[model samples]
Target: MKPETPFYITTPIYYPNAEPHLGHAYTTVFADILARYHRLIGDDTFYLTGTDEHGLKLQRAAEAKGVTPKEFVDSMVAIYRNFWGLLNISYNRFVRTTDEDHIKVVKYAAEVMYRKGLIYKGNYSGWYCVDCEKFYSASEYLMIDGRPHCPIHRKPLEWTEESTYYFRLSEFREYLLNLLKNKDIVYPKHFRQEVINKIVGQELLDISIARPKERVWWGIELPFDKNYTVYVWFDALLNYLTGINYLSDKERFRRYWSSTHHVIGKDILWFHTAVWFAMLKALDIDPPKKVLVHSFIINKGLKMGKSSGNAVRIEDLLGRYLSSDGVRYLIARIFNLGKDVEVSTSLLDSIYNSELADNLGNLIRRVGVLIKKKLKGTLSSESIDNTLTDKADTAVHKFNKLLGEEYEISTALQEVMGLLKEANAYINSVRPWELSDPSKELYTLMEVVKVAINLLYPVIPESVSKVAESFSIQLGNPLDISVDVGKEYVVKEAPILFKKVR
Candidate 1:
């Protein structure tokens, strides 16, 4: 048999300086959904996500807690892992920047670039944000009270001068420009233009890739120079290679790396695109197959972040929704790749209530109960209704097109929800509950429900699985789903998939 097509996806290794929050959950859940979708379609998928443990910010945070850097990160990493587990993130590998293999990868890459004359020692002076772990040019920083401040954090920027090793990012400006123009490498075509515009507007300068050990000592030390450590961003980015077994397993690495998709937030666009592309070129490696960028989840008129002090806690959402699937569905429902999503409890509650509880949950309850109560829990084969079948088929088609082709996850979900709405309407029109022999109508409705639930499985796996099991429905490949009127459906029980949030 031919092998399943390889599909590799990754989330940015999060910085574990703070606990996991809504922002973290947003990105990770989105990646998880895509990963789950690929797996559902019979793809050999690998999802990678984890923590970035080395930086000056982490060093000071550890000091403030009176613990060693490793000790603090150990605890924080545990929290991140626990939170991911709570959210049902099905990551194939959880890579840490401090892992020995990752550290080695960073050092190896740096050494290759150094030998190729792409990295050189240089003195650097710039406005920097400790929170961001990045330097900002004059045009990049915001001026508040006549002083430079971090655009994201809204905090004062620090002026620092140090000797560091620099990567020749400027040399690859033409290469990156040509790359961004390909239009297929970055999703949401506008983001590709955004990167191209940035490269065209500003001269791509050589980026500092190392920090002096005297100031920040928690990172991977350079192989050639023990006095300097690899910059946090540089070190963190290599976790992608480490996660794919870049150095340890060549055949496996080649198979997965050929199909890599890096799912990242818009804030890191520059590094992931311009700098990352250059680094890969310097290492004689090809760029990733695609770089998927997403806008942020906003709260209180600011991008939700721990440092911004506007981050919503993940626990709070779980408490409100009462299940990981609820939170996942809400996020998938509101997810946007092009624009920022402003989140509020009211908005979330409305979506959960209207979509999950009222629409999907209601359909499942009605169908299962009707089958058990009226049909004696047994549904025999009968001719399927063409109207409901057409709606289900269109929904399946649009869903696959929007999600698989356009990567419009929210739009894809809307298509599925529309199917549910149609099924609910069909129920009202046919009045299955009132009919003495509504076996055909019920079977038709069940087929539509089967399609809708299968489409929703990626976003709400647990809830969908429960509904499928209760109705004895076979969750098959979404692309090939059709109205199976000949199959027998034995309803064991009507499961309450999602409880309405009061």
Candidate 2:
């Protein structure tokens, strides 16, 4: 929590075969909000997001387009980076599984595991879905009318027999179970329970960690076998650490990895929780501090349901709102922790209209407009009345109290919104517009309104900064986590924070 201590977090490096979507925007926004909030509270946070370019999925997509895998991944990655950049998502590092440093670290992790006898030769024969990018155990694969179907794609999985190197995952059952019991290995508590109740609840299978070096040559080549490439997960999984590997960059890796957290999807819980921990322990490194698994975004109020043709795309949301924060705010507000949220344009519109426009935005406009009219464009640092202030006096307190312990962004925003709502109602009842008089009593009442605007600085900052400047009050002074409201405050000028959405 200290500024000097690193708070390292990462999104699951995305597969680059498809264009980015709402699902991609969901977790990145979640992490970005946390990053922005923590930095505001003085935490030294580092957030990493990027594409996982090398996989059989990308390889096949490239072939279908008649382009080399490199060409396909190169162009696709550009689109992903540009999309995130457009949304103002500030990622500290954009990791690629195909990067030279990552390739070496993956090989290093494999070699260490292999040298420690955690690796062994094996033959894998199963229904493998290239599109799904995962091998299904018979229990998981749906036998549709007789053929194996991908649980995700709901299509048949290709059967394959390959000379592969397997990680003896089944042997780590009790080890992983104890780690789960320990609870710090993964987090958001409920998702960890899901991992225990579901996949890890089933018998752990020895995972195929390498493919025939020739067939799936898109991944890190195994150090122990020139004939095989390390499996996507076996290497791809280590990126959380490779960005700060002990053997490679001991001090930096140790500092960062010791406090790492992974924000991942619920579907991939098995790899992050069970397999990832097993690999790190074999290498004598500690597992990540926590793994936060969030469920996917659903359409039409159910997470997995699809519409007739199109699903909710982040692109569409951005096109409509011209702001990613609206999308981020909806995702944060609507979903309970680790649960899927169905997003519709209607849901997006409702939040934007109700929360941002009406509550937050209208409060600023009503207050700023009245101050300008009454005070004659001169910002007031004069004391205001407590009649209007008393109604919402607890809001600033509630925001700091809730977020002081841990950054609950939505909850804090809600508290701030609650106060804004109260201030708007108070202004309506007191008729601060009619309170524009020369009396000392009337001047005191206007000061209370200015204090309320000062309280709103955290959530909708830009407008409030204008409010601060209009009165010539110092904005940054009260922005600190330990901020306190001054007795006298004034609005310098009115600047519009929210333009009415067409």
Candidate 3:
């Protein structure tokens, strides 16, 4: 079905310098869930996720492996795609920064900025991290063992000086302040204040947007200058626009760009907001509709990163959970946009065994067995219990509010799980097993299950699809769900969606 309203969301094109980890899965899965939700509501949705291939880190990593940068990323991109496929990421486009179209778009934008005096040649010297591909000032870098270190990697920073080009990021200080204050561009409200505080306390200096080819040759070169390549960060940021065909397909770009939501981690908040918005302003384009920032998933008392070596492998998660849906459910349950989530295997096991296997899975199994044994696998329309109906209605309302308005995915899952719990208790109390004609009770329970499953479909799609098929439920728009109980249902064999781990 063709959707009427356009909705677009993007995950930060990940740096594919190494194998993907839980940190990468966390962000991509969250974006996938959001994209699924929008599609569920009949919105035209486009999801973009890809690899950030051009950078000093990739170049160095490739050199260590005795392969060209292109050869290395070519192999790494396959791994990323396979991992995303395993997790069931439903992205419409997986854009690579090394793609010819992306490179052209970067050069085109750079040329335009230079022509309009928004970009100029300049000399820059600062402490830089090859891993992060950005400069850190005195206040931003951490003092570690009497040396300045990259806060994220906790590695020693290199002091480098070069003649480069700078983007006039400083010129839009007042504009950014007003935009942040007046518009609902950033999510969780507090993140907005954090950016505002930074702007108020410090200066927005013109950012260096080019690197000398002698230092970093694996990047998009400047259109006007052959001696320099566009900074990796600057080139990377343009993938968002390139993914949407900003230069090639203007009409399509306008449609999706108007409702664009860039999903990112808090570490890059300044770049996405302070730098990105100004770049758009220079291009005479409107800022993205929302920059949804999420806090990191912490493991072992530190942010999970490949460099940190505390990162959880995606294979380990899949091996433990036994399915993509299981991993997806765990991520959705712990998803947080405001605060860092400290994660462990025990936490993942508890949520899976208690919620998916015990509560939701147990209810489906019991209900399916009783309905098949008693009603011979067919049920006619009947009046649903008002108490259960009211609970389902309330859960749906709160789920929509939390997910659609507040972007609180964890709370939204809780609301649906709460409804499932209520249904489980309702079944135990009603005891449909004892009664000979338990159609009414069973019907009520199934209605409640339908509501819960629809709400959860965005998170655990595979499990939800299985339950939907067994229970004869049409997984339609969640908003269309009500407890009217007007249709007939055919119960097939009961399926165990999630088996308890140990």
Of the candidates shown, which would achieve the greatest lDDT relative to the real structure? 3
Off by over 4 Å in 3: 1-3, 127-160, 301-308
Q: Could you give candidate 1's per-residue lDDT for residues 171-245 as a string of tens digits?
A: 998889888886479887898898899899998889889888987888999988999999988998888899989
Predicted structure 3, TM vs. truth: 0.94
Q: Whose TM-score is higher: candidate 1's or candidate 2's? A: 1
Instruction: List the candidates' TM-scores in order.
Output: 0.94, 0.85, 0.94
* lDDT for position 40 in model 1: 89
Q: How large is the C-alpha RMSD of every model relative to the true structure?
A: 2.9, 4.1, 3.0
lDDT of each: 0.89, 0.68, 0.90
Model 3: how far residue 78 lies from native, Å: 0.3
Q: What's model 1's lDDT at 102? A: 89
Where model 1 places Cα greater than 4 Å from the true spot, the runs are 127-160, 301-308
What TM-score does structure 2 among the candidates reach?
0.85
